[model samples]
Target: MPDADNYGNPDYPAQLAEMARVLQLHRGPIAIASHVDADGDAVGSVLGLQRALRALGKPAQAFLRVPNYLAFLPEAGEVSPPRAQLEPGTLLVVLDVDSSDPLRVEGVAIPSGAELVLNLDHHGTNSRRADLSIVEPGKAATCQLVKELVDSLGVPWTADIATPVLLGLVTDTGSFRFMNTNGAVLRCAAELVEWGASLSWINNHLSQQPKSHYALLVSVLSSMEFHFSDLVVSAQINQAMLDSAGAGWEEAEAFVNTIRSAQGTELAVLFKDYGDNVKISLRSRGRVSAQAIAVACGGGGHHAAAGATLNLPYLEARATVLGKIEEQLQIDGLR
Candidate 1:
């Protein structure tokens, strides 16, 4: 089993110390990776730690591929795609993802030939083991854990290092608007800013979406759906919609957040139809558990946001998801 501890566990500092020691002792190349889809938190965590390791004269590479929207992050272009296999004796650090599942780790069938696999994440649902894992569900983002781990490594903070780390904090907290934006993470953000993290640059890039994004957003909004007396809302995007708007999944990824803002919505769903399967993203407000609904469908995430990919076709998946949400509503006595 992986050595695991929550942030408040008395042993947490010792665990971090040991992880730091492991990284320091490893002379082999270090490969950093995160979940697929390469959201801002994943991209930022990967890039930030990769730069920090390199600064320590450790051979580290970001084993992640990002979406176009995230490509603007500092050093994002330098990241390599996950390989079919890694060099022997490589230390593979998978961040912001459940490291126990190779499928979720992105790019590789399994991390073959890795000497050690370390999982650093903040997902409460993560249950599997890695060689070593520090899972803190209380954290606002994995970047917060990354910041602590980097501190343990004695790596001096720099703009290049701090910027990507801040990217994770900024985006994962929804630019500090999400519920996960706690005091500790806000303090971390302030420290990163002090270390020359370019907050304005990140905000500017994020705010400046392409025209296609607006087109795609418009289409998704037009597909507004309501269930359970407007307590639940949803929208969908299919390949047809993507083609019509000349947009991509990246453009549609955040649409769930849009629909979730509808007044008095308890739950919101964004369904991305891919003909044979549908990807479901869920967001919930107050006492409703989006993660529970997602977990029921074989997906995992935070209380407020989560997702799952269903093998069933769009209509079947839609029915199944709606059923799950209704069941959850009933359980919560909201129906």
Candidate 2:
């Protein structure tokens, strides 16, 4: 059984057992994929599972549209984009992906002959299309759930495995400062530390920004806007700004939190103009639902942190998203 403190469906153990059985019965290679943005939780979950399966003497490969900052992770060099050819009966496991839509996984198509699809995630908006899925929305991070699955499968705990799992928990919980941080989260962190996970190294690497990244942050902050008596704050980054700072989309991660930190701000938004589309990141300080706003804009994510891509000009996208946030605030009587 999963630890009582872990957040998951009551039947998680049974599902995990069945998955193990399937892996034991199959003789084909397993391919793991995750969301493209590849945050710490997403990357950690994918790499951690790959290591665990390999430790079990199973043939496994991992795939992701790798994020540059995460290249330091163990076996990260092995991560690749989805392959065009997969052998028949190959099992495809997707980790930490919030939506079943191919676009959500960065257009990674499921190969023609996959015997089974396993979706391991902690997103409430998951479409549940996998043959077997363990979606635990209450968990702080998918890596946290992955740790539970690893333990239930009796996989050996090694520093290689524990490091990534701890990375996921730390980043997803904002260094254990997010609202989801709970007793189980702390306990899991303590256990991982005991298993040789280095908290200081993880925190330093994640928090240390390059000079260019700080420049990008300055540009974004310079464009900040406030609305609804500063209850809703927004900042935008254009390709020009990114070029000036010599930065990319990954460098802009967590920049929205700066906006959210402003006093009286209940909702914060970061809009990144990616030429063809604008990616909108939403963050909330409890009074509004970021997930609701993202979903209304044809995107999905957690209640506190959500994102959507708008196929519109920068100004149009900003207006559309702000309109939705305002509507949600009105409905919730926050305006």
Candidate 3:
């Protein structure tokens, strides 16, 4: 394999080149997949790569259900659900997912019977042993890595491809408001724009939300609780709230970002009741590590943001998660 020449190169450009070289050799169907409850970065990375692969004349398809809010993305209509089985000799490419854990991936199991499995991700915790893995934890978004891969693949940039890749950069950085936004991210955004990415169109679609979303937001906010001199703030959203507001889990997206914006909040936590279990989203500023908190609870994510699902009722899950956050804050000397 040409890629074996520089396997595990510390330099990412070389790593991307190796990935491209390997991908270019495949002459079979390609199926793309990502994490479930797809976010902007996941959706953007999947669509961007899927479109680029097709442009390379490979029979590539994206497998995941697009959330209602993200259905406006370019070529999102082409996305399909996870298949029971893929064509023989298919190259399965999984993106934005940190691990091969079935619970974290979109479908029940990483579809089998592929000629090769390629995993692309930007999470520090990812240790998936795919046939080929391109895991770069420092990347601001997987789309940034995707952009480099697309360039290496010799696929000419188009609005269809650039737009979704830029979407991943924008959303993953909280529209450049989060801690990960840096000069490289800004420069990449500018380059994608030059390639005809529609910034206004992405922003306009991101800005509009339904009335039910706002109603759900109200419930999420009203449930807020402050701890440790207001340095840690927590909130909750349950199925009842969603039903009452005629909303779905998608409507609760970024509610943790909202709570994290509170002044002096070093750590913000949002607990979503999932009947039998509770999903906890964690966001931390400064030296606090959200990833550490999530990992200690059997989940994983980046330093600034992470999540875990506790197999306990809401009350018990809330207490367990809060205890972990408190311990983390104490270690950071913020408690």
Candidate 4:
């Protein structure tokens, strides 16, 4: 029960093992720094790990770099940004994120001399900036990975613990609807539900079922254009869409998903004009790795979904992003 041996399969990557080593090395204070506005995946990872670390008598604190969607989860009151820098005996553990500049914590900073117990993500575009980076692209969600860690820790996976992680799993998998979702993900999500993760509540928050919620969708649909024999679909939005929907930048993060939701779109792109540059959002179905398309433009994410923000003028930036997608289309023989 000490390590992953206590859990179902201990899906412990070499990264988790390295985390234990760093814990032992410090054996005193440890800090868990994570992003806030934390979806189920992020909050779950932070909460589960913080609990495990504290159980070991390690001084662990969960830091939120941003405000969470408070209407959604409870990890908020229990969470707050941690003070910058690790204690002399503290080890810093960063989880479930891909940015080195994550948190953009205005006044917060990591101790320049602190040892990092990095739990790097397994995402294809993971930054792997931690001391012990745990990159497990093989796992469907970081929460699933954290659940493995929690199970191996030998403590019961109660609803309080499982709910947060389950939320993350559901969010990341698009409520078990994304193509990345496999039997393993379903099995994991089912277990979380069995462990008391509330699907009804999760669905209420996640599903874009509300008719009023379709404002952004309406905008995307109205602006959408088909290309490449209808295999490629694209849309362009200006700040006007957000103003119309009363959504801020965070709320519009899924703008491209709206475009991709169209039935016949094998590839979908949304170019949101930001004046100086455009935020390029890309999504693809089948074997279309949108991440590759974005990374080609110097951005990255999973194969089907990825994006990049360019500082160039709107038309020029849009041209560059579409050009990359065209290059990919030729490479994939979709053209």
Candidate 5:
């Protein structure tokens, strides 16, 4: 069972409270950044934290490479594109990004005179590049930790706050179906619902697919292949397929999930061809550690879900990644 206090860290509450106090004391314009190819957890964490800061009467700006499909999200229009520069002495809060490199913060450059760099994330692979970091790998989602922090600050929860937070919880947990969805996660989700999260609306928007997205899915599915006696399923998507389907990277977000859901499959891999590099997303059942496979490929994430980027052509990258996954399976006696 997971720890009940501090959501796995006894010091988490104090650390979060102190961070909140510091942000409140700064009294300067705050800038928030999250990862590109933003998912519900990323989007929810960024928007929820942005809304919370503003509700506290602090001036905050949220930045993301907002996808057109995500515009339906509340406050989606408010997300700014990454600016080449930031104001000096600004407090920049980066959320749900695995790397501490400023470039990973959706192309936003960290101003030289920035007062503080804070990284809030739930990924175990976080690089700890921020001046202050709160990384709880055991939490179901980063948004869950954000909710705890906001609540500790005595910020009253409203629909605006609860909705996005809940969206993060729902998406990250696979609607409470993933392994990380613990008792505390469920309780937190229950509270969000009590606070007026629109369950149906969030589910509908997240699960509904446009015709173009369906076309992209078909393209990916048509390319699916199985390895290791059907225990490992894989798929690929090239840029041409994306363009032909009139879809963006975000539209392919759920492809790995669809592949992973194959009956009797223990692992799923999606290789996205991005001209210069191939982006790999890995998902697995309990039999394999996706993170370990990713780490071997110089990437990181949780045991069940992880990703990596390889600076190799599609065939070469696929061979290398599949080799790593096969090695892991052999070690675990699955091959």
Candidate 6:
């Protein structure tokens, strides 16, 4: 665990070390289940750990439940769902996912005597339900923790590992432009780069991937609607809008964050009717806790980014969410 030892000495608790020790015992086979979005952080992390697991001579596989069309990541062609040959006592390592949404764990049917459910993530709202949960909400990305966590397997960090790991760190930090970029993040970035992870290469794949064919950004901006007297900027995308663009739900993801990007905007909500129920995403660039808002609306996310699904129509969900935000603003003022 020398590589693990280097990142956080006394800062990392002994419990995390113990959790890593438990993961090492599953030497035969492992199943790595992760979110399907394959966002930079998610995909990069899956790749990093998958590469590492193979290097350790451990039979490992990466599984994604979602379809590939909506997941337009850089290495989408390379990632396929894992095979179903996982042994009865296989180790299940769940990464970058919060247990608040356990329904995502479908009928993989792990044995009752499964060795370990390694939950590794950096989300503040994590469930801590893993046999070993190493949650450092302060860290930039789960991929950062993943790199450190696998070091306990006695594997050294290399170019193969650093490339994918960098995807998570770079994107999660908003290309190192966000407030979360602290000394630890910078140090990890430097180390990963020195090991042959190219920042420009990663950014080019994500940031500079010509948006020419897609005019969804323009269409979204044209219809961008603001509420709360412009303090809150909101947007909604119906199925018709998706048809107009060459994209779908994932393209609309940038809307909520776009609202938060505006000057003087404090709250942003992006409503998308994704069948049966409407999916609501909340983003707050100010001191407000978007997580609390989402929890109120039956969703969960971090303080800045939160989401939930509402049974009501688009307008009702909007009013309900806005009312709650207003209530919080008043209560905050009363203090």
Clashing pairs in 3: none
Against the reference, the lDDT scores of all candidates come to: 0.87, 0.83, 0.85, 0.67, 0.84, 0.69
Q: Using alpha carbons, what is the TM-score of model 2?
A: 0.94
**Candidate that would win on lDDT:** 1
> Which portions of model 1 show Cα errors greater than 4 Å?
1-8
Worst 10 residues of 5 by lDDT: 98-107
Order the numbered candidates by lDDT, best leading: 1, 3, 5, 2, 6, 4
User: Residue by residue across 238-323, what tens digits does model 4's lDDT show?
Assistant: 77787887655555556677677777768988887888878777878865668888888877667876777788898899788778
In model 6, how large is the Cα lDDT of residue 66?
44
Instruction: Please give the lDDT score for candidate 5.
Output: 0.84
Residue 335 in model 6: lDDT: 17
Extract clashing residue pairs from model 4: 37-68, 40-168, 41-168, 120-134, 122-136, 289-303, 290-303
lDDT, residue 101, candidate 3: 62
Candidate 3, poorest ten consecutive residues by summed lDDT: 1-10
Model 4 CA deviation exceeding 4 Å by range? 1-15, 20-26, 35-40, 51-58, 65-70, 82-88, 99-113, 127-129, 208-214
Instruction: For candidate 6, write residues 1-335 as lDDT tens digits.
Output: 12332254464657566756765667766777665344667767777887787777767766654433324443544455644445677787777876334543422333324466777777667777777777777777888887776666667778878888987898787788766677778888898999888888777666542252256667667767776667777777777778777666666665666666878777788888765668788877647778888888887767777778888877787788878777765555521
**Clashes (candidate 1):** 0
Give TM-scores for every candidate, taking all chains together and pairing residue i with residue i.
0.96, 0.94, 0.95, 0.82, 0.95, 0.85
lDDT of 2 by residue, 60-145 (tens): 88877667777788663667776666667788888888435667674257533567888888888997888888788888899888
- In terms of TM-score, the best-performing candidate is 1
Give stretches of model 3 more than 4 Å off.
Answer: 1-9
For model 2, how big is the CA root-mean-square deviation? Answer: 2.2
Error of 4 at 218 (Å): 3.1
